[model samples]
Target chain A: MAQNPNRPISPHLQIYRWGPHMAVSIFHRATGFVMATAGMLTLLWWLASIAGGPESYATFQSYVVSGGEEATGMQVAINWFFRLLALGVTYSFFQHMFSGIRHLLMDLGAGYELKTVRTWSIAVYIAALTATALVAMLVAARFMGA
Target chain B: MGNGTKLGRVRGLGSAKHGGKHWLDQRLTAVGNLLLTTWLVLSLLWLPNFDYETVAAWLAQPSVAVPMILMLANIFWHVRLGLQVLIEDYVHDEGNKFATLTLLNFYVIGGAAFGIFMVAKHAFTGAPA
Candidate 1:
């Protein structure tokens, strides 16, 4: 139905003046996509590895958990990278989840004020980082037998 | 100042397609993911180790397995919805978008079915002695 579908979308990233709200908007989709692809793949792989029993799970642990001592050069680096990516995926979960909460409130006809909007957009960063940190702490505590 | 009738001016003006069902599904799934992913994180945190035996035993619990299945299903559904919006907005070419969206449908369904089957497998079969 378009004689001309030349409607302009939003400005490109370089030209657009950025804000936390804008970042939140972008991160919401970015995080969702990350979780959908990499996070989901890893989760499925993790499950399947475990289901294959300790033999396969040991390989997962060595690569995913410990950058094993025997690993050299690129091997250790790749292992560590996947380990870092796991944390990144965790952060993505919180970032997307908190931003979703903010959007949910907006859906319910609340937090529409300009000031409130800005506050929450920034708060999502702080909250997500804090939650990820807490998860790290809990995991550390468990490993330490505390 | 150019309108024969109010309806005339507004004839084809909207998304011109399905209204807000996509929007509503996104929000509803968001709420479900919020609850279920939280449960997943907590359950994972409670486990002592990530070893096959320990984690597998944990998942083998009926209490854990049921929510795990639900959580996996809900998360996949939410992801699928989000990806649909994303692919629609960004991928403009009709053929390419159609192919991408079709791949997405299969990916999400296969992922969810596989995950659900895995959970059921774990539920029925405990880790080795």
Candidate 2:
């Protein structure tokens, strides 16, 4: 079939002006991928560690959390790295959750208007951070109080 | 165009008959993940501590174990569907798409099975009710 070479084609990622909705949409998938890989692997490790008994779980805790009292320099660095990774996963979890909620709302035929969607898209970012903060506070209080 | 009815001419051209099913399953698992993940964060939060004993005892209960297993399965399924769509969109070559997709399924299934098995073991042998 013959086609016009000069025809204006669809604008792509670089061609369009970036917007909150576009950013959020991409983040949703990126965050989802992160969770499905790193997050889920960590979870499986946690579960398998528990099943392996206290000693095994203690190994996990030492590596992932405490770095052990007699920590080698390498152990300290690795443990901190895992801690940062965990934090990243936590943030991604919340981010994915709120973005997912936004999607669910749209699925129900709500918030389709340009203004409403833009407002809610931005709200997803804030809500995810707020929820993550709440969890951090609650966990901190629990650990500190005891 | 081929001496057939309109329906015949358009048969198997769009949707491929399976696309709708995949779309619906993705949304369904999304809802499942929303509930399961919420329950998990809240449950973990409500627990007294995050130590090995505390966490292990928590998962040992049938109530917790059942839901956790379901959550892991649901999440794996959801991820498989999501990644399949992602691969479909980005992996243009037929051979590459098939290879990646096969690996994706293998990874998801292996992870899900291990997770569920670990949870079940904890539930059965870890702590007394």
Top-DockQ candidate index:
1
The CA-based lDDT of model 2 is what?
0.88
Model 2 shows how many backbone clashes? 0
TM-score per candidate, in order?
0.88, 0.89
Span of ten consecutive residues with least summed lDDT in model 2 chain A: A1-10
Q: Score candidate 1 by TM-score against the native.
A: 0.88
Q: In model 2, what are the clashing residue pairs, if there are any? A: none
Per-residue lDDT of model 1, residues A35-81, tens digit only: 99999988887787766777777877767776566877777777778
TM-score of 2: 0.89
Quote the positional error of residue A35 for candidate 2 in Å.
0.3
Per-residue lDDT of A22 in model 2: 88
What DockQ do you compute for every candidate structure? 0.55, 0.52
lDDT by residue (B1-129, candidate 2, tens digit) is: 354554578776676678788889999999999899999988988888888778888899888999999999999999999998889777767788899999999999999999999999888888744
Model 2 ranges with Cα > 4 A deviation: A1-12, A144-146, B1-12
RMSD of each: 3.6, 4.1
Off by over 4 Å in 1: A1-7, A144-146, B1-10, B13-17
Chain A superposition TM-score per model: 0.86, 0.86
